[model samples]
Target: MAAQLNHTIVWCSNRSASAKFLTEMLGRPAPTHFGHFDVVELDNGVSLDFADANAQIQPQHYAFLISEADFDAVFSRIKDRGLEYSADPMGSRAGEINHNDGGRGVYFRDPDGHYLEVITRPYGSSG
Candidate 1:
C-alpha cells in the first residue's frame, strides 16, 4: 500500500480539553483516552493524539474540508459561542467567512491557540 498519514501528535497544555475542543468543533464523537494521550479520530481514519506538555507550544494550523450543511452547523456554533473568526488565515478579515473557490471558508482558534479552518470545498477546486 502507498504511504498514508495514520496519526499525529498534538502538543497541548491539556490533552483532554484540546481533544474535546477539536471533536466538538468538527461535530465528531467525544475523544477517547489512549495511554497518556487523548485521541480524536477523524472520518478518514486518521487520528490526532493530543498529549499534555509543560513546555511552551507553538500554534499549528489544521484545516477541514466539510459539507455545506456541516459548515453551516459549525459556523452557527462558532457564532453562538462568540468566537472570533476570519475569512483569511492571517485573521485580518475578522468576523467573516470567505467564499474562496466558490465555497465558504472560515478560520478560528482552538483552546490551545491552534488555528482551525473549515471549508466546504478544497482550494482551487472551483473555477
Candidate 2:
C-alpha cells in the first residue's frame, strides 16, 4: 500500500479550543478525546490531533478541498461568526473569496492563528 498521512499533532495552548475551532470552521465532526490529543478525524482517514505546546507556537497553514455546496455552507458559517477571511493566502484581499482553478476558496485564521483554507477545487485542477 502507498504511504499516506495518518495524523499530525497541532501544538496550541488549549487543545479543546483549537480542536473545536477546526471542527466548526471546517464543518468536521467534534474531536474525540485521546490519551494526549483531541483527535479530529477527516473523511480521508487522516486525523488532526491537537496537543498543548511546550514552547512558542509557530503558526501553520492547512487547506481543505470541498464541494461547491459545502463551500457555501462553510463560508456562511465563517461570516456568521464574524471571522476575517481573505481571498489569498497572504491575506492581501480581505473579506473576499478566490475563484482559483475554477472553484471558490477562502483563507482564515484559527483561534491559534493557524491559517486555514477551504477550496472547492484542488490547486491546478482547472482543465
Candidate 3:
C-alpha cells in the first residue's frame, strides 16, 4: 500500500480561530475539537491539527492543489473578506493571481500569518 500523510500540527496563538479561518477560506467543514487541538480535515484525508503555541509562532507555508472551480470559489471568498493576496509566494505582486503552469494560483496569509497558497495545478506540471 502507498503511504500517505495522516496529519500535521500547526502552531498558532489561538487554535480555534486559526482552524476556523482555514476551514472557511477553503470552504471546508468547520474544525472539530479533539483533545487540546482544533482539527480541520481536507478532502485528501490529511488533517491540519491546530494547537496553541507556548513560544513565538514561526509562519509556515502550506500549498493546496485544487480544482479550477474550487479556486474560483476560494478566490471569491478571499476577495469578499478583503484579505491581501499576491500572485507570488514572496507577495511582491499584490491584488493579482498568477497563471503559473497554465493554472491560476494565489497566496495569502492565514490568521496566524502562515503563508497559504492555492493553485489549480501542481508546479512544473503541464496544465
Off by over 4 Å in 1: none
TM-score for each model:
0.96, 0.96, 0.95
Best-to-worst order by lDDT is 3, 1, 2
How does candidate 2 fare on TM-score?
Answer: 0.96
Q: lDDT by residue for model 3 over 1-127, one digit each (tens)?
A: 8999999999999999999999999989999999999999988899999999999999999999999999999999999999999999888899999999899999999988999999998999983
lDDT preference between candidates 1 and 2, better one: 1
Candidate 1 to truth, TM = 0.96
Q: Counting only residues 3 or more apart in sequence or on different chains, how many pairs clash (N, Cα, C under 3 Å) in candidate 1?
A: 0
Best by lDDT: 3
Off by over 4 Å in 3: none
Q: What 10-residue stretch in candidate 1 is worst by lDDT? A: 17-26
Q: What overall lDDT goes with each candidate model? A: 0.93, 0.92, 0.95
- For candidate 2, give the lDDT: 0.92
Q: What value does the lDDT take at residue 101 in candidate 3?
A: 88
How would you encode candidate 1's per-residue C-alpha lDDT over 11-122 as one tens digit per residue?
Answer: 9999988998888888999999999999999888899999998899999999989999999999998998889999999989998899999999999999989999999989
What is the number of backbone collisions in each predicted candidate, taken in the order shown? 0, 0, 0
Cα RMSDs of all predictions?
1.0, 1.0, 1.3
